[model samples]
Target: MKTITKYIKISALALVATFGSCSKILEEQPRSIYEPGFFETERGIMGGLTSMYAHLRWIYGQAYWYNTLLTGTDEVTYAQQADQNFLVMDLSGRALMNAENSRADAIWGICFSNINTANGIIEFAQQVDGVTEAHIGEARFFRAFDYFLLAQTFGGVPLDLGAGELTFNTSTTRSSVRNTVPEVYTKAIFPDLLHAAEHLPETGRVVGGVTKTLARLYLAKAYLTYGWWLENPNNIPTYPAADRIDPDGHDAQWYFQQAYNVAVQGIENPGPFRLQQTYYDVNLATNDRNNELLLYADHTETSEFYNGGSLTWGNGGAPDNFAGWMLTWNYTEIRSSSSSSAWSAVSSVQREAAQALGRPWVRMAPTIGALSNTFADKTNDSRYDGTFTTVYRGNWNKAGIQGPLYNANYLPVNPGDAILTFLNEEPTQAISYGAPFNSNVGAGVLPGRADFVISPSGVSRRIYPGLWKLGPYRTDSGSGLGEPNAGSTRPFTAAKFSELYLVAAEAAVKGASTRAGFTARDLVNVIRARAGVWRWDNNGNTERIEDNSAAMIASTPAEITIEYILAERSREYFGEGYRWHDLVRTQKWTQLASSYTICGPNIGDRTPIVFQRNIENFHYLRPIPLGQLDAMEGDRGIYQNPGYD
Candidate 1:
């Protein structure tokens, strides 16, 4: 990422107040007055860090920004036609988003602002005797983390080392040239992380704070991303590269090995982190502070609400709340305000699923092929069943409020409705009509299009399977009033330790020079074992995906390849935010996307949608926001990325 952005939105002096700026550190300044030297004290240090985290949380939690990352991958895709920016991103054609793009600009601003704040903390904290190493370490970790994200998003950014701390004049006169991808990683990212690892404690801190293991995790990720960027098969490196940024030119193999080493260190380290016992527990809001999370963009039920509805009516623009993750809801979930009076020739199981789920904002939908491939082992592979909303134990308080409920499985007259659905299946031995009691029926068959029906009210509802993870069904005081809407309380899982298995396995299969003291197969099998997949040979502890090629099981680790690792990654972190980057870093965007042949039932008349998409090598990085260039007076040394208009 660029080290110094010529144009600065957040002034540096406002970050960590410098010492000696105040007449004396002895005087207690008013609560409102923020001047230099205040940050030298423990209170100022904590306040500065707290403010920085609050700002970071707001930046990372935007629905628009999150959508950009979630959809348009092998695991997920945008479904709504009206969300043009989402479509453009998911379909992969635009070099630059339209001039008024909010998500892109917000991310750019937030990342750079945090970067500047970190720099101030580091500079000021190092000068103070009372300030501890932990403070500086946290600052370094955030700096590295922000830069790493910027590099992944925008290729390269300015290298600013707190040069303008005394002067608040950031946007006017300060000029900074761009750094190369390798330079960002080697000089800034690597060094900051090393410092962070050195100072960050081994255990126990706030949920959002970094640990030694977390720092190591970021290092592994950095090495992998840097390695991939250096040896990108489709795109040539833009040089002359920075000094010692692999001046000797190592191949991707070496980088993968390095990544393996770092990942293994984090994996084997005696830390508080561990995978949750169940896949669903990994993301349950109640499990927000679980051991599986190394670090996450923290949100709470009261404070950091998802607040998606608030965005549309001008209540908030690109708000901080992280709600309405459309990735979890499939196309079938219809808005409650719309038609709900009729069920036309639909199974009772389908009705139960519909009733049980939260509000369906089907902006993004999973392709049928991706779903079939991902959940092929529906009976086992606890992940597939565990993560999705297959059944609904009716809470009559919520269901009864819907009023005049239809399904016989709904015993609202008694305790409540406890029913479930099998989207595509038609199991034997069931009542041909009313409510399905023991709905074990699997997908009966596929219509050439998606499996859905036009309700008797003539409303088109696409009924592919929906994930239960996205439902933040909080209140049921009234029907259709309390559902997952804009500004509603819904939590998004920003990061988790479960992905370590995937990352470690990717490095291992890519032929890490040395073993991680465990084989790639072993790493993957460990995850599978936790999931308790019934299809796998439990006694032998070997996975048994029917379609896994015979050649892949051969003698060497290379046979375990990137493909197997990706499939496993999708199964494990399906709706989580890893899909797009995973595809891009491995140079498999087009290859993986090209595999989509089968499609789901469409709500609209749009015909014959195929899975194959238009992803190009140039799409490896998103275009720098047009505003940034315009801010540089059109010629502040930074240039637009290649292939973007």
Candidate 2:
């Protein structure tokens, strides 16, 4: 169901507060009350489940979460913002992330809070007669999901398991249950997911609910990520204590095989899932319940869509606007003199194409590596056009002019002069740019140039691709329902079923698990075909994806290696916020991103000045949040992840 009906009042338990209040009294409850009595009945169990699901909205809805994931990866960099908090060291490659980093703290807090919430629900569900395996299974799935994020992002964290490990009261002093990476995998993430997979409904459900298929998807991904750690124990600084290591053989290959098996099972199942015709279709609000989505953090504009979809305060599970929407919008927009006219630029498009023309926060921009290298197949790939924008029409309204153009300068603003014009086709050096540029294109003249060179430097006329994926799609300020600024309220995707294809392809290449009896080529080709990359297929291995590093040529399925797979993943999922984890898990962050110049004058001409970041081996994990360190009563402060202050 898109909206889970509430049957019982949600508990604001003491896990959040050291001696937090227990569930409310049943008789006094508003329609329903929260308490042990509620847990004992089916209605109460379902309501509690609804509350647990609400935790997801909290975890994924924050803007900072997206910022943490996207910045400093191989794909993105920040725009110059005088008020920006991130440093150059962060977004370039080496994220000088410290325990005090607010983003880290937010991530830690959100995950653990939800983790404890899930634990409480699971604990109560076990003793209830009416709460069947599904109720417990749902709770178990979340326990593992939150832990999986914790394990991947922070290495090891306090293993709460409803243990009051994170309680915030004064009298209830307890130590952190933080354990090692492998322990977290075995005791926390993997087992919970396994239980969830075994008990969750095998039949289809909406993206908002946990299903057997979704459980398996996460299990496979967790195993896939853990497999990387198993192979190179030394590479990760958060290695488990000597005792935590298996004495008998659990190797990377074992994890891979496990992941492969689960993935294959999910794929082979007669589930309601298949690739959508276009990448855009996967995320449109209209097709939200489509089969291709395995799981997602749910959000809705109306209460009808979700039980409390619009109830912000009383209902714990009301959907929220992602905090990162503003950040993502700012970073990915084109910098233009006429940028204020963005709305005017879109005045002619269909109403659905409500053009807000983002505020040029330019807090992040596509790395030159992302823009030029990833989409090497300029001719066939549909993703290129779908993901980015090239042409920028003028918004004469904001500019207070017919069109944005000038001869040499505005009032002859030399040196600082800028021009705004469209190029019907790319220009050769031979084309002349007449002054006071007009739409008239002379035979050998560039269409929109007005003495393009004499008045402006190349910078003035340059318009980079706006990351259209996050661009506002609706602008009906007509509703008075937070319209206009309401664009950010659009739901952001946290995961996609399409990633399963990439997972299977990568697994096949590593020989860690069954190739699903399909070659990496076949799996990748399915996505590529959907992406409109009409290249070689499983039929004959006719052509291989281009990496842009090499000349255009055909490579066979045999050439489908991890490097190509990673490159392909970049093409398919760059702005969706997977780059850092993608590179880190694949052990490619340092090799691919460390040397990137995030800010300052173009060391080689691509990077625009702002903040910068780099990657180091220790960077694989973000520092444990400082608040967590301060709260720990023991010398447990010694447990801080290395390389952070």
Among the numbered candidates, top TM-score falls to 1
lDDT of 1: 0.55
For each candidate, give its TM-score against the true structure: 0.76, 0.75
lDDT of 2 by residue, 1-645 (tens): 000001112223211111112332111112223344545555555555555555555555454566667666766655444123344325443334567753655556555555554655666776766667876888788778888888888787666422243221112233555677777788778878898888888753323567888888888889888888776544555633324353335877777777777776777773666777666556444555577766655554444234223322222122344333333322222122223322221121111222223333444555555665676565556566556543333333332333443231222112122222222233455444333322121111343442222111221102334555555443333432223233244555666677776787777776754544556777777677677633322111135443321122233245687778888888887777677787778887766765433323221122233333446677788877666667556664466766775
Over 4 Å off, model 1: 1-38, 92-102, 161-171, 236-245, 248-251, 303-319, 328-356, 391-404, 408-463, 473-483, 486-491, 533-558, 594-608, 636-638
Lowest-lDDT window of 10 residues in candidate 1? Answer: 452-461
Q: What lDDT score belongs to each candidate, Candidate 1 first?
A: 0.55, 0.53
Which is the leading candidate under lDDT?
A: 1
**How many residue-pair clashes does candidate 1 contain?**
30
Model 1 / residue 253 / CA error / Å: 3.7
Q: Which ten-residue region of model 2 has the weakest summed lDDT?
A: 1-10
